[model samples]
Target chain A: MSTSPTARRGNAVGDAWVIARRSLKHIRRQPEMLTDATIQPIMFVLLFAYVFGGAISVPQGGSYKEFLLGGIFAQTIVFGCFGIAIGLATDRSTGAIDRFRTLPIARSAVLTGRALAAVLIGLLPIILMSAAGLVVGWRTHTGVLDVLGGYALMVLFQFAMTWVGILMGSLLSTPQAVQGVAFTVLFPITFLASTFVPVDTLPGVLRTFAEWNPTTSLSGALRAQFGNPDVVAGTSDAWPLQHPVLYTVIWALTIIAICAPLAVRAFNRATGD
Target chain B: MAIEATGLVKRFGDMTAVAGVDLAVKAGSVTAVLGPNGAGKTTMVRMLTTLSQPDTGTITVAGFDVVADPTEVRRRIGYAAQDATVDELLTGRENLIMIGELHHLGRVRAKERAAVLLTQFSLDDAAERVVGKYSGGMRRRLDLAATLVATPEVLFLDEPTTGLDPRARNELWEVLDTLVDSGVTILLTTQYLEEAERLADHILVVDHGRIIASGSARELKRRIGGEQIRAVLRDRSRADDALRLISEATGGEAAFDADADAVVVATAGGAAAVAAVAGALAEAGIEVDELALRAATLDEVFLELTGHSADAAIEEPV
Candidate 1:
């Protein structure tokens, strides 16, 4: 042949970027794909901040609107799982995975690319919700370092949640199946935590679960860093609430430690020869 | 050989999808694996393209072992699957550019190549349009263009024209013809005998996960005694006379087909035998209800070799 196929070896990060760009373009073309990160979080802010803001109260003396933003940030970041799961499942069903497998690029690029894009997509809700928070009378009355640290924690938690999403996407066979999982499994998991309310008000059994849940710790950590209402120290015996930042770090690392390799293994098994 | 395989076998649980098959395709030549739906044509293509591992086999494409060096094999080959595997959300040009970038072509070169391929595939008008809005034919063309972004040496097409209409299929066939002229080795699978007859330099007829026959189209037809001229008689009483006249005219043995109420004779002569039979029958004052000159179709060849119709669906073991 006059133009023989040239061999070009691709590095993992570069290859992953190319794959991620494809998904990011999908988001651009179908902005509806970001509904979970954009429209849903804003709707939750309106629902909880206005519709239910009057009925609920923070544990300590603080504005309920300010307390609600931290929880909203935590809840939306966790739901970042749905986007990756649905994206991977759609690629699998459409035979796009097969096409990628036949290419000379690094095999891990497919999953890593989706994970990278998910984390980036996770930022949309954080930014949009922060704007919504300000409009709803929420403020972070803290120094720049503490606010940066809180945003850092949310991104770190988003990275952890991306792995969980990879695992779910690998296990599920279809986008419809992923949707079923998002509603039946993930929806309940987010609700069971202290996302919209204080753990102290939950039922006895659920209160313990909420205090230990990563979503609760993440929310509590954001509230503490933002100088919003939080659990009064030494009053509650729950260690996770007292040390929310450290607990959230532990939870984030633990999740990545457990789910990352399992997600990779599951993805390899699903697409392997 | 551009592609070679030996003792290829793949089993899914209790069922064998490809059973001890072998192949050797020469450089710049086209080979077609002709078969029914469940005849393991796709399974074999998957193995050859390194998309699936064979339980027992050795396959080498472009001189690299598929099992031992799949990356090398992947670098030299392109595959267009039965399904149009392009992303629906991406525009045609964007899809090609993405694949080009994945192939590690620099961004400038990738974009330039995408433009060229778009125009070549007659997709320039819809280059910026998302593939979700493209017609079935356009999608397949874009899928084919994506595979050609790197100008792969060996191409594997699994039923490339399976869902396309006749005009689209012909257009694709013409593109393939040009590729072959430029010395690209192709291994394609199809259920259409006409497709195999038109494009394949060699044909392998697969059934029940095994190749029951292999040769050029003409050779396979010759094996089934070349063309057959069948004359359905208007009157049953003239069957013997018609048979005798047909045999005399064609200088071949003619038989009475009780099931079809016709006299059938095989001939190496193609259309000329039909003229001779017509003249002889007219001279004898006999009228034929229907007369036809036909070559052995891939379906007829399958029946001749395996005693089953081509459309008989074999249960695919899950």
Candidate 2:
């Protein structure tokens, strides 16, 4: 009741934080919502490290366990997009977004809040996977600064993916549909990249596609920063793998720049206030 | 006028939801948009609330144009949609505080306002409980409370009691009455004629994307004549004679209802008309099963205006 006319113009940062706090409350009320991000990533780490680590070999003298850690970290962060998509879609279907749209707040604050919460939530899987990686004898030979830089890049990539999630969520009408579409589109993209296997082992068309996949740059950057050897020497001679850190940063920024505007526009149409 | 809308038209694909409607609501009065399903009541409310834009029209709410300055309009009005719009995961207090914060109320003020609203809506007991655990009436009260977080000058409720039980419906009506008494102009939509009669200062009957009738509740009843003199015949064979006698006594045309085996005539004179008809029927030896005189209801008025019963209006498509 004390809202001033100037304040009604919107405090994007404060409003977005308020919106983010709401999402955090949801996580507190229903811990099961975090299951896919936490337990699932840990399960993936254990399965691949114990089951597939023995057979697969890094092209260089590096341990496959160390090589696999970078890939797992990259895959887990990208999958965080699934949570964002489903949460936004659910908000839309439940009329939460409709109520928010009528409020005297910036339209972008709603998505900003969801995006921020997804990034915060994304941190859990990264930390959990890192712990699982250490348990599986995955050690980083690089210095402390490089390790921090690597995690920072991974978080940035997750932030970029959040925009993609928002776009998908805004376009889809139902939470179930968002989950279905996110799985269908993201599954092939994650697997086709160098996340689980060496790009050289992929057949002709997939190998060429993997060489250019953003996930390839993300995983390669993490591996290089962690001082883990590349999976295949001949296959990853491309510009993205050659300067993985720079390429990863560029890919993340580009995805955010393109997806952010499209997502906002789609949100306006979807909520329609 | 607190709200002025002229030639509002909205169309969805092949269907016209609102077709060239106009309205002028005073600064402090309750106006009910009375209609059945698909009568464009929801669409009209949506447009005025700035939740949806009209295909072509001009609407101003609380002195600001809905399209040109939606932010200003939104700042001045509150809307509780048909679908309850509270976050089920958050507690009722949390939902209200969140909305208050979104409206740019400072953190302290937001919390203070949330407390005030919870108590006002009689939701203080359920304030800390998650909305998902609350019953239908509690959630609806919370949703309405959420809209009042900023203390809006005008309130728009779209079918506020569509699915509530009779008891809960009456409770909500009392809450709305208190809000109106506080000088907040209200525009509510309802399918129930009784609801409109009880709550509305002025009623607009909408059918098939158009306003079919508009007047005060009493004036609308007067349009169909003051009161109805209804009589059930003892024998269906004498329905014609009973109808003729009732019409002669009341000096009004009387019609026979085969379904009820009754003759009903509309008359300005209330008890006197009923007595005269009874005497005439007795003189003709036309036995009567029952007789009564009652004020003309909005239901009868709707039937006379639209050539269809109010209940039948529910099944029509928008």
Candidate 3:
């Protein structure tokens, strides 16, 4: 009956894994829960690659279709945040969090399990979008390690986005509100960045904001690592773009550092009432 | 004591949900908190379960201070909220097992416990079906079973059978009876007087976030006075005579219900008073078709204590 501190920590991790498995079970029972992370992103890839590829120009002899892959991947991964937010909000409204809170498990395990599940599910869209990109004549000309690094960066960004999702979810009271606010905020943040177009092509104010945006750094880093086209020859001179990998890593770490604690606090406040 | 709280208070902005309440539940006893909606039953349960902090008060559950050692309290207690809290997408078995695992039971133990609970609650037939497909009663049983996954010594149930049918409610009562017999201390909040009467070893009647009365079911009924001896005559002509005879025999004033052709008298003497009245009526050659002694209902006791019925409390706006 006696438990050491390490044993308790191990139990918390195990509990988190059990909760993550429950989320996976939900996906199994209702595969359509994954449409946002899979079908929607694939649709976006196809729509942009075929419909808008001719109008958009790629720099440094890069094909527009190949250049579009990085942006699409970045935008899709960031959108994964919306899924996590909505899921947590639903759990809150349904009194699931109340049940979880009463258990002896560590409090952080609930959010950790949710974030882990989001990351696991988030990988689907990345893979599906890459497949869709390949079908549309997009190819990664980088070495194997570079391509793997590009994906690792995308997954890391997804993990950071999960914390943001948890923070927003804990702050919001209901699933409907979470969806409404997340879409309103995320749409502009993703679209205004260099996700669908070069930052320089945007208006002056937007260009400045887009250059500093985390989504822009994520896409720029993927483009660099995957050896896709630099977004625009002159726009690439920005400090974030010049050191895209470092900037993206910093953004990811800063988001986790800031939002993780905020999310735990928000969760406690939301459920305490 | 398995659960104890003194001057527990909780507020949401300007409104007080629980206003200076006190409670103590002995080990291996079922203590029922009886109140209508907005009576702060849920708030009190939440604080005791360590789901919410009390605004101003002290609470201890299973020998652990709720505020100072909430994790220790959580480890010793199980709570089944008013809402069914089960994951709808998961099967009944999975929901039970998931809760078991979260309680730190390993996978094998969790599965074994889930199976035992499934059969114990008679949910084995529906074990593999998703909770969304289960009926209301089945969902409630599963929710109760989920809380029992760790075989907690103390159980907190908030309006456990609020929306169940009479049959389902009876079934739940049976399950609770078994748990109480097995020495699990239960502190449940309910609006059903009969539920408290049937299951509670001690009943605390709450009104406006305050404990209005506390005692066993019989003691509560006695607070409003004991049984009422009601006698019905075959002829209305003898109503006055019957009332007079009953008053003289029982030494209590008797009221005649003209519509029902019956004379009613309240008495603390219970069956002896009824016997006295019947003897007097027979000696007077009074023709009586029916005679009965009825104890005061909990509703009347509640009304007498609060100056309002439990029904009226239900109608108050949240």
Q: Per-prediction RMSD in angstroms?
A: 3.5, 3.4, 2.7
DockQ each: 0.55, 0.49, 0.53
Which residue ranges in model 3 land beyond 4 Å of their true spot? Answer: A1-10, B315-318
Q: Give lDDT tens digits, candidate 1, residues B50-115.
A: 899999989989988999988888888889989989999999999999988888887888999999
Candidate 1 overall Cα lDDT vs. reference?
0.87
Q: For residues B1-318, what per-residue lDDT tens digits would candidate 2 score against the true structure?
A: 888999999998899999999999998889999987888999999899888999998998888899998888888788898878899999999999998888888888889999999999999999999999998888888988988888887889888887788888888888888887888888999988988888889999998889988999989988777688889988989988898888999999999999999999878987898889989999999888899987777888888888878878654643
> Estimated TM-score per prediction?
0.91, 0.91, 0.94
- For model 2, the stretches where C-alpha displacement exceeds 4 angstroms are A1-9, B231-246, B253-264, B268-293, B313-318
What's the distance in Å from true for residue B29, model 2? 1.2
lDDT of 3 by residue, A1-273 (tens): 212211122366887898899887776677667677678888999899888888887655678888888889998888788878878898999899999989888888898898889889888889999999889988888899999999999999999999999998999988899889988988998998888778887788888889889889888899888888866556457788778899999999999999998999998898877
State the lDDT of candidate 2 residue by residue for A170-200, as single tens digits.
Answer: 9998989987897888888888888977888
The residue pairs in collision within model 1 are none
Clash list (residue pairs), candidate 3: none
User: How does model 3 do on interface RMSD, in angstroms?
Assistant: 4.0
Evaluated against the true structure, the overall lDDT of model 3 is: 0.87
Relative to the true structure, how large is the alpha-carbon lDDT of every model? Answer: 0.87, 0.87, 0.87
lDDT of 1 at A176: 94
